[model samples]
Target: MVATADLYDERGEELASLPLQLRDLGGVAEFSGPVRTIRCFEDNALVKAVCATPGAGAVLVVDGGGSLRSALMGDLIAASAVENGWAGAIIHGAIRDSIAIGGLGLGVKALGTNPRKSAKAGAGVVDEPVEIGGVVFRPGATVWADRDGVLVER
Candidate 1:
Protein backbone atom coordinates (compact mmCIF):
# COMPACT_ATOMS: atom_id res chain seq x y z
CA MET A 1 0.00 0.00 0.00
CA VAL A 2 1.08 3.60 -0.61
CA ALA A 3 1.78 5.98 2.18
CA THR A 4 -1.28 7.70 3.64
CA ALA A 5 0.44 10.98 2.92
CA ASP A 6 0.40 10.21 -0.76
CA LEU A 7 -3.17 8.99 -0.65
CA TYR A 8 -4.03 12.36 0.88
CA ASP A 9 -2.33 14.19 -1.97
CA GLU A 10 -3.91 11.94 -4.58
CA ARG A 11 -7.46 11.55 -3.33
CA GLY A 12 -7.67 14.96 -1.64
CA GLU A 13 -11.20 15.47 -0.32
CA GLU A 14 -12.40 12.03 -1.27
CA LEU A 15 -11.18 10.55 2.00
CA ALA A 16 -12.45 11.04 5.56
CA SER A 17 -10.08 10.67 8.45
CA LEU A 18 -10.73 8.97 11.79
CA PRO A 19 -9.50 10.93 14.78
CA LEU A 20 -8.11 8.51 17.38
CA GLN A 21 -4.93 7.63 19.23
CA LEU A 22 -4.99 3.93 18.42
CA ARG A 23 -1.93 1.71 18.76
CA ASP A 24 -1.04 -1.21 16.54
CA LEU A 25 -1.13 -4.60 18.21
CA GLY A 26 -0.89 -6.93 15.27
CA GLY A 27 1.97 -8.32 13.24
CA VAL A 28 0.85 -6.56 10.08
CA ALA A 29 1.47 -2.85 9.88
CA GLU A 30 -1.14 -1.82 7.29
CA PHE A 31 -4.51 -3.09 6.14
CA SER A 32 -7.63 -1.76 4.49
CA GLY A 33 -11.11 -3.03 3.61
CA PRO A 34 -14.84 -2.39 3.91
CA VAL A 35 -16.00 -2.15 7.53
CA ARG A 36 -18.13 -4.52 9.63
CA THR A 37 -19.17 -2.69 12.77
CA ILE A 38 -19.85 -4.02 16.27
CA ARG A 39 -21.17 -1.91 19.10
CA CYS A 40 -20.65 -3.21 22.60
CA PHE A 41 -19.51 -2.15 26.05
CA GLU A 42 -17.11 -4.27 28.06
CA ASP A 43 -18.42 -7.37 26.35
CA ASN A 44 -16.90 -9.35 23.51
CA ALA A 45 -19.37 -12.09 22.69
CA LEU A 46 -20.50 -10.30 19.57
CA VAL A 47 -16.94 -9.52 18.64
CA LYS A 48 -16.07 -13.21 18.90
CA ALA A 49 -19.06 -14.21 16.82
CA VAL A 50 -18.40 -11.69 14.06
CA CYS A 51 -14.72 -12.47 13.75
CA ALA A 52 -15.23 -16.23 13.62
CA THR A 53 -16.95 -15.85 10.26
CA PRO A 54 -15.06 -15.57 7.01
CA GLY A 55 -14.16 -11.90 6.66
CA ALA A 56 -13.36 -12.11 2.92
CA GLY A 57 -10.95 -9.16 3.42
CA ALA A 58 -13.13 -7.02 5.64
CA VAL A 59 -12.26 -4.98 8.73
CA LEU A 60 -14.06 -5.41 12.03
CA VAL A 61 -14.71 -2.22 13.96
CA VAL A 62 -15.72 -2.84 17.55
CA ASP A 63 -17.11 -0.09 19.75
CA GLY A 64 -16.55 -1.00 23.36
CA GLY A 65 -17.36 2.46 24.63
CA GLY A 66 -13.68 3.04 25.28
CA SER A 67 -13.85 0.84 28.31
CA LEU A 68 -10.59 0.17 30.04
CA ARG A 69 -12.08 -2.15 32.60
CA SER A 70 -12.00 -5.26 30.44
CA ALA A 71 -10.50 -6.34 27.17
CA LEU A 72 -12.91 -6.60 24.25
CA MET A 73 -10.49 -8.73 22.23
CA GLY A 74 -7.68 -11.15 22.92
CA ASP A 75 -5.35 -13.54 21.19
CA LEU A 76 -7.97 -16.27 20.85
CA ILE A 77 -10.54 -14.12 19.08
CA ALA A 78 -7.92 -12.41 16.99
CA ALA A 79 -6.52 -15.75 15.88
CA SER A 80 -10.00 -16.92 14.97
CA ALA A 81 -10.48 -13.87 12.78
CA VAL A 82 -7.22 -14.51 11.02
CA GLU A 83 -8.03 -18.15 10.52
CA ASN A 84 -11.35 -17.08 9.03
CA GLY A 85 -9.52 -14.74 6.63
CA TRP A 86 -10.17 -11.41 8.25
CA ALA A 87 -8.15 -8.48 7.07
CA GLY A 88 -8.02 -6.55 10.33
CA ALA A 89 -9.66 -5.52 13.58
CA ILE A 90 -10.12 -2.04 14.99
CA ILE A 91 -11.22 -1.77 18.58
CA HIS A 92 -12.54 1.35 20.28
CA GLY A 93 -11.69 -0.26 23.59
CA ALA A 94 -8.93 -2.16 25.27
CA ILE A 95 -7.57 -5.60 24.33
CA ARG A 96 -5.35 -8.20 25.90
CA ASP A 97 -2.60 -10.57 24.78
CA SER A 98 -0.67 -7.89 23.03
CA ILE A 99 2.42 -10.05 22.63
CA ALA A 100 0.45 -12.98 21.24
CA ILE A 101 -1.54 -10.83 18.86
CA GLY A 102 1.61 -9.15 17.58
CA GLY A 103 2.81 -12.50 16.32
CA LEU A 104 -0.46 -13.53 14.68
CA GLY A 105 0.27 -11.75 11.39
CA LEU A 106 -3.05 -9.98 11.63
CA GLY A 107 -3.87 -6.29 11.57
CA VAL A 108 -5.19 -5.05 14.92
CA LYS A 109 -5.49 -1.58 16.36
CA ALA A 110 -6.86 -0.72 19.76
CA LEU A 111 -6.91 2.09 22.25
CA GLY A 112 -4.84 0.14 24.76
CA THR A 113 -4.29 -3.25 26.36
CA ASN A 114 -5.80 -4.84 29.43
CA PRO A 115 -5.32 -8.10 31.30
CA ARG A 116 -8.96 -8.77 32.05
CA LYS A 117 -11.32 -10.41 29.60
CA SER A 118 -14.78 -9.18 28.77
CA ALA A 119 -18.11 -10.74 29.65
CA LYS A 120 -19.75 -13.44 27.56
CA ALA A 121 -23.39 -12.49 28.00
CA GLY A 122 -23.98 -12.46 24.26
CA ALA A 123 -24.33 -8.69 24.36
CA GLY A 124 -23.70 -5.97 21.78
CA VAL A 125 -25.21 -4.95 18.47
CA VAL A 126 -23.74 -6.12 15.18
CA ASP A 127 -23.53 -4.26 11.85
CA GLU A 128 -24.50 -1.03 13.58
CA PRO A 129 -22.90 2.37 13.21
CA VAL A 130 -20.39 2.96 16.00
CA GLU A 131 -19.05 6.29 17.15
CA ILE A 132 -15.75 6.13 18.98
CA GLY A 133 -13.74 9.04 20.25
CA GLY A 134 -15.95 11.35 18.21
CA VAL A 135 -15.46 9.30 15.03
CA VAL A 136 -18.28 7.46 13.30
CA PHE A 137 -17.53 4.00 11.85
CA ARG A 138 -20.46 3.03 9.73
CA PRO A 139 -20.98 -0.25 7.92
CA GLY A 140 -19.63 -0.47 4.35
CA ALA A 141 -17.24 2.41 5.05
CA THR A 142 -13.79 1.89 3.68
CA VAL A 143 -10.95 1.80 6.25
CA TRP A 144 -7.31 2.35 5.43
CA ALA A 145 -4.61 2.14 8.05
CA ASP A 146 -0.85 2.46 7.76
CA ARG A 147 2.04 3.86 9.76
CA ASP A 148 0.58 7.32 9.38
CA GLY A 149 -2.95 6.68 10.70
CA VAL A 150 -6.35 5.13 10.11
CA LEU A 151 -8.67 6.91 7.69
CA VAL A 152 -12.20 6.28 6.49
CA GLU A 153 -13.89 6.80 3.13
CA ARG A 154 -17.59 6.58 2.52
Candidate 2:
Protein backbone atom coordinates (compact mmCIF):
# COMPACT_ATOMS: atom_id res chain seq x y z
CA MET A 1 0.00 0.00 0.00
CA VAL A 2 2.73 2.43 0.93
CA ALA A 3 5.25 1.14 -1.59
CA THR A 4 3.49 0.96 -4.93
CA ALA A 5 6.62 1.22 -7.01
CA ASP A 6 8.16 -1.76 -5.27
CA LEU A 7 5.06 -3.84 -5.74
CA TYR A 8 4.73 -2.82 -9.38
CA ASP A 9 8.30 -3.68 -10.08
CA GLU A 10 7.84 -7.11 -8.61
CA ARG A 11 4.65 -7.88 -10.54
CA GLY A 12 5.69 -6.08 -13.70
CA GLU A 13 8.77 -8.21 -14.21
CA GLU A 14 6.84 -11.42 -13.87
CA LEU A 15 4.03 -10.29 -16.16
CA ALA A 16 5.77 -8.92 -19.20
CA SER A 17 2.48 -8.59 -21.06
CA LEU A 18 1.14 -5.96 -18.70
CA PRO A 19 1.65 -2.38 -19.68
CA LEU A 20 3.83 -0.24 -17.48
CA GLN A 21 3.38 3.42 -16.57
CA LEU A 22 -0.28 3.99 -17.41
CA ARG A 23 -2.09 7.31 -17.15
CA ASP A 24 -1.79 8.83 -13.69
CA LEU A 25 -4.80 10.24 -11.88
CA GLY A 26 -2.74 12.82 -10.08
CA GLY A 27 -2.55 11.70 -6.44
CA VAL A 28 -5.24 9.09 -6.60
CA ALA A 29 -4.66 6.31 -4.10
CA GLU A 30 -3.82 2.82 -5.40
CA PHE A 31 -5.37 -0.51 -4.47
CA SER A 32 -3.67 -3.83 -5.12
CA GLY A 33 -5.42 -7.19 -5.63
CA PRO A 34 -6.54 -9.83 -8.09
CA VAL A 35 -9.36 -9.03 -10.53
CA ARG A 36 -12.96 -10.19 -10.03
CA THR A 37 -14.93 -9.10 -13.03
CA ILE A 38 -18.64 -8.28 -13.40
CA ARG A 39 -20.43 -7.43 -16.61
CA CYS A 40 -23.46 -5.37 -15.76
CA PHE A 41 -25.42 -2.45 -17.03
CA GLU A 42 -26.96 -0.41 -14.18
CA ASP A 43 -27.71 -3.08 -11.61
CA ASN A 44 -25.17 -3.75 -8.88
CA ALA A 45 -26.83 -6.65 -7.10
CA LEU A 46 -24.13 -9.03 -8.26
CA VAL A 47 -21.53 -6.48 -7.37
CA LYS A 48 -22.87 -6.36 -3.86
CA ALA A 49 -22.76 -10.13 -3.70
CA VAL A 50 -19.10 -10.28 -4.76
CA CYS A 51 -18.07 -7.51 -2.42
CA ALA A 52 -19.96 -9.04 0.47
CA THR A 53 -18.00 -12.26 0.11
CA PRO A 54 -14.61 -12.35 1.82
CA GLY A 55 -12.33 -10.52 -0.60
CA ALA A 56 -9.50 -13.00 -0.28
CA GLY A 57 -7.21 -10.34 -1.80
CA ALA A 58 -9.20 -9.43 -4.86
CA VAL A 59 -10.50 -6.29 -6.54
CA LEU A 60 -14.06 -6.02 -7.82
CA VAL A 61 -14.11 -4.86 -11.41
CA VAL A 62 -17.60 -3.80 -12.38
CA ASP A 63 -18.35 -2.96 -15.98
CA GLY A 64 -21.40 -0.77 -15.67
CA GLY A 65 -22.00 -0.11 -19.34
CA GLY A 66 -19.92 3.07 -19.04
CA SER A 67 -22.89 5.06 -17.88
CA LEU A 68 -22.22 8.31 -16.14
CA ARG A 69 -25.89 8.92 -15.50
CA SER A 70 -25.93 6.75 -12.38
CA ALA A 71 -23.47 5.58 -9.79
CA LEU A 72 -22.83 1.88 -9.43
CA MET A 73 -21.29 1.92 -5.99
CA GLY A 74 -21.98 4.29 -3.13
CA ASP A 75 -21.24 4.82 0.54
CA LEU A 76 -23.30 1.88 1.71
CA ILE A 77 -21.72 -0.66 -0.67
CA ALA A 78 -18.29 0.82 -0.21
CA ALA A 79 -18.60 0.54 3.53
CA SER A 80 -19.52 -3.10 3.07
CA ALA A 81 -16.51 -3.69 0.85
CA VAL A 82 -14.18 -2.16 3.39
CA GLU A 83 -15.71 -4.03 6.27
CA ASN A 84 -15.58 -7.26 4.29
CA GLY A 85 -11.85 -6.77 3.56
CA TRP A 86 -11.94 -6.08 -0.19
CA ALA A 87 -8.67 -4.78 -1.54
CA GLY A 88 -10.44 -2.23 -3.74
CA ALA A 89 -13.03 -1.60 -6.44
CA ILE A 90 -12.64 -0.44 -10.04
CA ILE A 91 -15.83 0.68 -11.60
CA HIS A 92 -16.02 1.30 -15.34
CA GLY A 93 -18.69 3.88 -14.82
CA ALA A 94 -19.56 6.18 -11.96
CA ILE A 95 -19.65 6.05 -8.18
CA ARG A 96 -21.36 8.11 -5.51
CA ASP A 97 -20.32 8.80 -1.90
CA SER A 98 -17.11 10.44 -3.02
CA ILE A 99 -16.71 12.24 0.30
CA ALA A 100 -17.22 9.14 2.36
CA ILE A 101 -15.55 6.71 -0.08
CA GLY A 102 -12.50 8.90 -0.38
CA GLY A 103 -12.11 8.95 3.36
CA LEU A 104 -12.17 5.17 3.60
CA GLY A 105 -8.88 3.21 3.36
CA LEU A 106 -9.83 1.42 0.14
CA GLY A 107 -8.70 1.58 -3.43
CA VAL A 108 -11.45 3.08 -5.63
CA LYS A 109 -11.08 4.15 -9.24
CA ALA A 110 -13.73 4.99 -11.81
CA LEU A 111 -14.42 7.20 -14.80
CA GLY A 112 -15.65 9.81 -12.32
CA THR A 113 -18.05 10.39 -9.45
CA ASN A 114 -21.77 11.08 -9.53
CA PRO A 115 -24.55 11.82 -7.05
CA ARG A 116 -27.19 9.67 -8.76
CA LYS A 117 -27.67 6.12 -7.52
CA SER A 118 -28.30 3.12 -9.77
CA ALA A 119 -31.48 1.04 -9.94
CA LYS A 120 -31.93 -2.24 -8.08
CA ALA A 121 -33.56 -4.17 -10.90
CA GLY A 122 -30.96 -6.92 -10.64
CA ALA A 123 -30.09 -6.78 -14.32
CA GLY A 124 -26.48 -7.86 -14.53
CA VAL A 125 -24.23 -10.87 -14.77
CA VAL A 126 -21.37 -12.04 -12.55
CA ASP A 127 -17.89 -13.43 -13.29
CA GLU A 128 -18.10 -12.45 -16.91
CA PRO A 129 -15.54 -10.78 -19.12
CA VAL A 130 -15.96 -7.05 -19.20
CA GLU A 131 -14.35 -4.25 -21.14
CA ILE A 132 -13.42 -0.85 -19.81
CA GLY A 133 -11.21 1.93 -21.05
CA GLY A 134 -10.28 -0.31 -23.99
CA VAL A 135 -9.02 -3.11 -21.79
CA VAL A 136 -10.50 -6.58 -21.52
CA PHE A 137 -10.89 -7.75 -17.94
CA ARG A 138 -11.57 -11.42 -17.40
CA PRO A 139 -12.44 -12.91 -14.08
CA GLY A 140 -9.41 -14.03 -12.04
CA ALA A 141 -6.99 -11.76 -13.87
CA THR A 142 -4.55 -9.80 -11.73
CA VAL A 143 -5.28 -6.05 -11.53
CA TRP A 144 -2.82 -3.56 -10.14
CA ALA A 145 -3.87 0.04 -9.90
CA ASP A 146 -2.42 3.24 -8.59
CA ARG A 147 -2.38 6.88 -9.56
CA ASP A 148 -0.94 5.56 -12.85
CA GLY A 149 -4.12 4.06 -14.27
CA VAL A 150 -4.84 0.30 -14.19
CA LEU A 151 -2.80 -2.67 -15.34
CA VAL A 152 -4.19 -6.13 -16.10
CA GLU A 153 -2.35 -9.44 -16.42
CA ARG A 154 -3.65 -12.93 -16.86
Candidate 3:
Protein backbone atom coordinates (compact mmCIF):
# COMPACT_ATOMS: atom_id res chain seq x y z
CA MET A 1 0.00 0.00 0.00
CA VAL A 2 1.18 3.55 -0.68
CA ALA A 3 2.00 5.63 2.34
CA THR A 4 -0.55 8.32 3.24
CA ALA A 5 2.16 10.94 3.58
CA ASP A 6 3.39 10.21 0.10
CA LEU A 7 -0.11 10.42 -1.23
CA TYR A 8 -0.57 13.72 0.55
CA ASP A 9 2.69 15.03 -0.82
CA GLU A 10 1.63 14.09 -4.31
CA ARG A 11 -1.87 15.51 -4.05
CA GLY A 12 -1.05 18.44 -1.81
CA GLU A 13 -3.99 20.63 -0.72
CA GLU A 14 -6.37 18.90 -3.13
CA LEU A 15 -6.65 15.92 -0.80
CA ALA A 16 -9.07 16.11 2.07
CA SER A 17 -7.26 15.64 5.33
CA LEU A 18 -8.98 13.35 7.82
CA PRO A 19 -8.09 14.62 11.24
CA LEU A 20 -9.09 12.14 13.91
CA GLN A 21 -7.45 10.40 16.82
CA LEU A 22 -8.40 6.98 15.54
CA ARG A 23 -6.19 4.28 16.96
CA ASP A 24 -5.01 1.19 15.17
CA LEU A 25 -7.14 -1.36 16.95
CA GLY A 26 -6.77 -4.27 14.54
CA GLY A 27 -3.64 -6.23 13.79
CA VAL A 28 -2.96 -4.29 10.59
CA ALA A 29 -1.82 -0.72 11.01
CA GLU A 30 -2.75 0.51 7.51
CA PHE A 31 -5.52 -0.26 5.05
CA SER A 32 -7.29 1.32 2.08
CA GLY A 33 -10.09 0.69 -0.39
CA PRO A 34 -13.38 1.98 -1.76
CA VAL A 35 -15.49 3.27 1.11
CA ARG A 36 -18.88 2.05 2.29
CA THR A 37 -20.52 4.39 4.74
CA ILE A 38 -22.90 3.84 7.62
CA ARG A 39 -24.49 6.52 9.78
CA CYS A 40 -25.49 5.27 13.18
CA PHE A 41 -25.24 6.76 16.62
CA GLU A 42 -25.24 3.98 19.22
CA ASP A 43 -27.10 1.16 17.52
CA ASN A 44 -25.10 -1.59 15.84
CA ALA A 45 -27.71 -3.69 14.11
CA LEU A 46 -26.97 -1.96 10.83
CA VAL A 47 -23.27 -2.48 11.38
CA LYS A 48 -23.77 -6.19 12.00
CA ALA A 49 -25.88 -6.39 8.86
CA VAL A 50 -23.15 -4.80 6.79
CA CYS A 51 -20.47 -7.08 8.21
CA ALA A 52 -22.57 -10.06 7.20
CA THR A 53 -22.41 -9.11 3.52
CA PRO A 54 -19.44 -9.57 1.20
CA GLY A 55 -17.19 -6.54 1.48
CA ALA A 56 -15.34 -7.07 -1.82
CA GLY A 57 -12.23 -5.41 -0.44
CA ALA A 58 -14.10 -2.29 0.54
CA VAL A 59 -13.73 -0.33 3.79
CA LEU A 60 -16.66 0.12 6.16
CA VAL A 61 -16.70 3.69 7.41
CA VAL A 62 -19.14 4.03 10.29
CA ASP A 63 -20.30 7.43 11.51
CA GLY A 64 -21.24 6.62 15.05
CA GLY A 65 -21.33 10.27 16.05
CA GLY A 66 -18.05 9.76 17.90
CA SER A 67 -19.94 8.28 20.79
CA LEU A 68 -17.73 6.73 23.44
CA ARG A 69 -20.66 5.89 25.67
CA SER A 70 -21.24 2.53 23.94
CA ALA A 71 -19.24 0.21 21.75
CA LEU A 72 -20.59 0.09 18.23
CA MET A 73 -18.49 -2.91 17.38
CA GLY A 74 -17.04 -5.91 19.18
CA ASP A 75 -15.09 -9.09 18.60
CA LEU A 76 -17.82 -10.90 16.72
CA ILE A 77 -18.61 -8.08 14.30
CA ALA A 78 -14.94 -7.46 13.62
CA ALA A 79 -14.40 -11.16 13.01
CA SER A 80 -17.27 -11.06 10.59
CA ALA A 81 -15.60 -8.20 8.72
CA VAL A 82 -12.50 -10.30 8.24
CA GLU A 83 -14.45 -13.39 7.23
CA ASN A 84 -16.52 -11.38 4.80
CA GLY A 85 -13.52 -9.97 2.91
CA TRP A 86 -13.52 -6.36 4.12
CA ALA A 87 -10.25 -4.53 3.75
CA GLY A 88 -10.83 -2.51 6.92
CA ALA A 89 -13.19 -0.64 9.24
CA ILE A 90 -13.05 2.97 10.46
CA ILE A 91 -15.42 3.68 13.30
CA HIS A 92 -16.16 7.15 14.62
CA GLY A 93 -17.64 5.58 17.73
CA ALA A 94 -16.14 3.02 20.10
CA ILE A 95 -15.20 -0.63 20.03
CA ARG A 96 -14.62 -3.38 22.58
CA ASP A 97 -12.31 -6.37 23.08
CA SER A 98 -9.23 -4.62 21.82
CA ILE A 99 -6.97 -7.62 22.47
CA ALA A 100 -9.23 -9.95 20.55
CA ILE A 101 -9.62 -7.42 17.73
CA GLY A 102 -5.88 -7.01 17.44
CA GLY A 103 -5.65 -10.73 16.82
CA LEU A 104 -7.76 -10.51 13.68
CA GLY A 105 -6.24 -9.82 10.26
CA LEU A 106 -8.73 -7.04 9.48
CA GLY A 107 -7.67 -3.42 9.71
CA VAL A 108 -9.71 -1.48 12.31
CA LYS A 109 -9.37 2.17 13.32
CA ALA A 110 -11.56 3.68 15.99
CA LEU A 111 -11.70 6.50 18.51
CA GLY A 112 -11.37 4.27 21.55
CA THR A 113 -12.65 1.25 23.44
CA ASN A 114 -15.64 0.88 25.71
CA PRO A 115 -17.01 -1.95 27.84
CA ARG A 116 -20.62 -1.14 27.05
CA LYS A 117 -22.31 -2.63 24.02
CA SER A 118 -24.45 -0.68 21.53
CA ALA A 119 -28.19 -0.86 21.12
CA LYS A 120 -29.25 -3.51 18.59
CA ALA A 121 -32.31 -1.60 17.46
CA GLY A 122 -31.42 -1.96 13.75
CA ALA A 123 -31.75 1.81 13.37
CA GLY A 124 -29.32 3.52 11.02
CA VAL A 125 -28.71 4.72 7.51
CA VAL A 126 -26.57 2.84 5.03
CA ASP A 127 -24.45 4.15 2.17
CA GLU A 128 -25.00 7.69 3.35
CA PRO A 129 -22.51 10.50 3.16
CA VAL A 130 -20.83 11.06 6.52
CA GLU A 131 -18.54 13.85 7.56
CA ILE A 132 -15.82 13.22 10.13
CA GLY A 133 -12.87 15.23 11.26
CA GLY A 134 -13.46 17.75 8.48
CA VAL A 135 -13.56 15.00 5.87
CA VAL A 136 -16.57 13.85 3.97
CA PHE A 137 -16.89 10.10 3.37
CA ARG A 138 -19.03 9.15 0.42
CA PRO A 139 -19.74 5.64 -0.75
CA GLY A 140 -17.67 4.45 -3.74
CA ALA A 141 -14.81 6.86 -3.07
CA THR A 142 -11.37 5.32 -2.72
CA VAL A 143 -10.03 5.92 0.79
CA TRP A 144 -6.40 5.53 1.72
CA ALA A 145 -5.60 5.14 5.40
CA ASP A 146 -2.27 4.58 7.11
CA ARG A 147 -0.27 5.54 10.19
CA ASP A 148 -0.32 9.15 9.12
CA GLY A 149 -4.05 9.48 8.60
CA VAL A 150 -7.03 8.73 6.34
CA LEU A 151 -7.63 10.37 2.94
CA VAL A 152 -10.53 10.31 0.55
CA GLU A 153 -10.43 10.45 -3.25
CA ARG A 154 -13.72 11.12 -4.92
Candidate 4:
Protein backbone atom coordinates (compact mmCIF):
# COMPACT_ATOMS: atom_id res chain seq x y z
CA MET A 1 0.00 0.00 0.00
CA VAL A 2 1.17 3.52 -0.72
CA ALA A 3 1.65 5.92 2.12
CA THR A 4 -0.58 8.98 2.27
CA ALA A 5 2.46 11.08 1.61
CA ASP A 6 3.17 9.13 -1.55
CA LEU A 7 -0.46 9.16 -2.60
CA TYR A 8 -0.61 12.90 -2.31
CA ASP A 9 2.52 13.21 -4.34
CA GLU A 10 1.21 10.90 -7.02
CA ARG A 11 -2.30 12.30 -7.04
CA GLY A 12 -0.97 15.87 -7.18
CA GLU A 13 -3.27 16.95 -4.41
CA GLU A 14 -4.94 15.92 -1.16
CA LEU A 15 -8.55 15.19 -0.55
CA ALA A 16 -10.38 18.26 0.67
CA SER A 17 -12.01 16.29 3.49
CA LEU A 18 -11.19 13.21 5.62
CA PRO A 19 -9.33 12.97 8.90
CA LEU A 20 -5.62 12.82 8.31
CA GLN A 21 -4.64 12.51 11.95
CA LEU A 22 -5.44 8.81 12.09
CA ARG A 23 -2.82 6.42 13.31
CA ASP A 24 -1.66 3.76 10.92
CA LEU A 25 -1.59 0.49 12.79
CA GLY A 26 0.83 -1.87 11.12
CA GLY A 27 0.18 -5.62 10.55
CA VAL A 28 -2.88 -5.25 8.34
CA ALA A 29 -1.96 -5.32 4.71
CA GLU A 30 -3.74 -3.29 2.06
CA PHE A 31 -6.91 -5.10 1.08
CA SER A 32 -9.38 -4.54 -1.72
CA GLY A 33 -12.98 -5.14 -0.72
CA PRO A 34 -16.59 -4.11 -1.00
CA VAL A 35 -17.83 -1.33 1.24
CA ARG A 36 -20.22 -1.83 4.14
CA THR A 37 -21.51 1.09 6.15
CA ILE A 38 -22.74 1.36 9.73
CA ARG A 39 -24.32 4.34 11.42
CA CYS A 40 -24.26 4.22 15.18
CA PHE A 41 -23.02 5.82 18.32
CA GLU A 42 -20.83 3.97 20.79
CA ASP A 43 -22.57 0.64 20.20
CA ASN A 44 -20.95 -1.82 17.82
CA ALA A 45 -23.17 -4.88 18.00
CA LEU A 46 -24.45 -4.24 14.52
CA VAL A 47 -20.92 -3.64 13.34
CA LYS A 48 -19.94 -6.97 14.81
CA ALA A 49 -22.82 -8.75 13.15
CA VAL A 50 -21.96 -7.33 9.75
CA CYS A 51 -18.27 -8.08 10.12
CA ALA A 52 -19.05 -11.60 11.24
CA THR A 53 -20.59 -12.26 7.89
CA PRO A 54 -18.44 -13.97 5.28
CA GLY A 55 -16.91 -10.86 3.83
CA ALA A 56 -15.47 -10.97 0.37
CA GLY A 57 -12.84 -8.29 0.94
CA ALA A 58 -15.28 -5.66 2.09
CA VAL A 59 -14.35 -2.65 4.17
CA LEU A 60 -16.51 -1.49 7.08
CA VAL A 61 -17.18 2.20 7.39
CA VAL A 62 -18.49 2.99 10.84
CA ASP A 63 -20.01 6.26 11.92
CA GLY A 64 -19.86 6.45 15.68
CA GLY A 65 -21.11 10.02 15.81
CA GLY A 66 -17.58 11.19 16.41
CA SER A 67 -18.05 10.38 20.07
CA LEU A 68 -14.91 9.74 22.02
CA ARG A 69 -16.67 9.05 25.29
CA SER A 70 -16.58 5.33 24.55
CA ALA A 71 -14.55 3.25 22.19
CA LEU A 72 -16.45 1.77 19.27
CA MET A 73 -13.95 -0.93 18.37
CA GLY A 74 -11.72 -3.09 20.55
CA ASP A 75 -9.36 -5.96 20.06
CA LEU A 76 -12.08 -8.60 20.26
CA ILE A 77 -14.22 -7.04 17.55
CA ALA A 78 -11.15 -6.44 15.44
CA ALA A 79 -10.16 -10.06 15.74
CA SER A 80 -13.66 -11.09 14.83
CA ALA A 81 -13.47 -8.86 11.77
CA VAL A 82 -10.28 -10.52 10.65
CA GLU A 83 -11.69 -13.98 11.24
CA ASN A 84 -14.71 -13.07 9.17
CA GLY A 85 -12.45 -12.01 6.29
CA TRP A 86 -13.20 -8.30 6.41
CA ALA A 87 -10.68 -6.22 4.53
CA GLY A 88 -10.53 -3.26 6.88
CA ALA A 89 -12.40 -0.91 9.21
CA ILE A 90 -12.65 2.84 9.38
CA ILE A 91 -14.11 4.09 12.63
CA HIS A 92 -15.31 7.66 13.07
CA GLY A 93 -14.64 7.48 16.78
CA ALA A 94 -12.28 6.08 19.31
CA ILE A 95 -10.90 2.57 19.33
CA ARG A 96 -9.51 0.66 22.28
CA ASP A 97 -6.76 -1.95 22.42
CA SER A 98 -4.77 -0.02 19.89
CA ILE A 99 -1.72 -2.19 20.36
CA ALA A 100 -3.56 -5.43 19.87
CA ILE A 101 -5.41 -4.04 16.88
CA GLY A 102 -2.13 -3.01 15.35
CA GLY A 103 -0.93 -6.58 15.62
CA LEU A 104 -3.84 -8.04 13.72
CA GLY A 105 -3.53 -8.29 9.96
CA LEU A 106 -6.30 -5.80 9.35
CA GLY A 107 -6.45 -2.21 8.25
CA VAL A 108 -7.91 0.15 10.86
CA LYS A 109 -8.29 3.90 11.16
CA ALA A 110 -9.93 6.00 13.87
CA LEU A 111 -9.96 9.49 15.24
CA GLY A 112 -8.17 8.58 18.41
CA THR A 113 -7.71 5.98 21.12
CA ASN A 114 -9.87 5.28 24.14
CA PRO A 115 -9.61 2.80 26.95
CA ARG A 116 -13.27 2.63 27.86
CA LYS A 117 -15.49 0.12 26.12
CA SER A 118 -18.88 0.99 24.68
CA ALA A 119 -22.27 0.25 26.21
CA LYS A 120 -23.95 -2.87 24.83
CA ALA A 121 -27.43 -1.41 24.63
CA GLY A 122 -27.68 -2.64 21.03
CA ALA A 123 -27.97 0.73 19.33
CA GLY A 124 -26.91 0.85 15.70
CA VAL A 125 -27.94 0.33 12.10
CA VAL A 126 -26.25 -1.76 9.44
CA ASP A 127 -26.00 -1.29 5.68
CA GLU A 128 -26.82 2.35 5.99
CA PRO A 129 -25.15 5.41 4.57
CA VAL A 130 -22.96 7.03 7.20
CA GLU A 131 -21.44 10.48 7.21
CA ILE A 132 -18.05 10.63 8.81
CA GLY A 133 -14.78 12.35 8.24
CA GLY A 134 -16.64 14.68 5.99
CA VAL A 135 -17.51 11.87 3.64
CA VAL A 136 -20.78 10.17 2.91
CA PHE A 137 -20.16 6.45 2.80
CA ARG A 138 -22.81 4.38 1.14
CA PRO A 139 -23.05 0.65 1.38
CA GLY A 140 -21.37 -1.10 -1.60
CA ALA A 141 -19.36 1.98 -2.47
CA THR A 142 -15.69 1.52 -3.19
CA VAL A 143 -13.37 2.73 -0.44
CA TRP A 144 -9.62 2.66 -0.41
CA ALA A 145 -7.43 3.86 2.41
CA ASP A 146 -3.74 4.23 2.92
CA ARG A 147 -1.47 6.72 4.67
CA ASP A 148 -2.70 9.45 2.28
CA GLY A 149 -6.20 9.34 3.71
CA VAL A 150 -9.29 7.51 2.38
CA LEU A 151 -10.54 7.73 -1.18
CA VAL A 152 -14.09 6.79 -2.14
CA GLU A 153 -15.44 6.11 -5.62
CA ARG A 154 -18.92 5.10 -6.60
Clashes of 2: 0
Candidates in descending lDDT order = 3, 1, 4, 2
User: Which candidate number would show the highest TM-score if scored against the true structure?
Assistant: 3
- Who is ahead in lDDT, 1 or 3? 3
Worst 10 residues of 4 by lDDT: 11-20
Which pairs of residues collide in candidate 1? none
TM-score of each: 0.95, 0.82, 0.97, 0.85
Instruction: Give each model's whole-structure lDDT.
Output: 0.88, 0.73, 0.92, 0.77
After superposition, the stretches of candidate 4 with alpha carbons farther than 4 Å from their true spots are 1-20
lDDT of 2 by residue, 1-154 (tens): 6354666577765432333232222123876777788878777777777778888778888888777888888877887888888888888778887888888767888778779877887788888777776677888877777775567764
Off by over 4 Å in 2: 1-28
lDDT of 1: 0.88
Worst 10 residues of 3 by lDDT: 12-21
What is the clash count for each candidate, in the order shown?
0, 0, 0, 4
- Pairs of colliding residues, candidate 4: 4-147, 4-148, 28-106, 33-57
Off by over 4 Å in 1: none
Candidate 1 residue-wise lDDT, 21-56, digit = tens: 799899998999999999899989999999999899
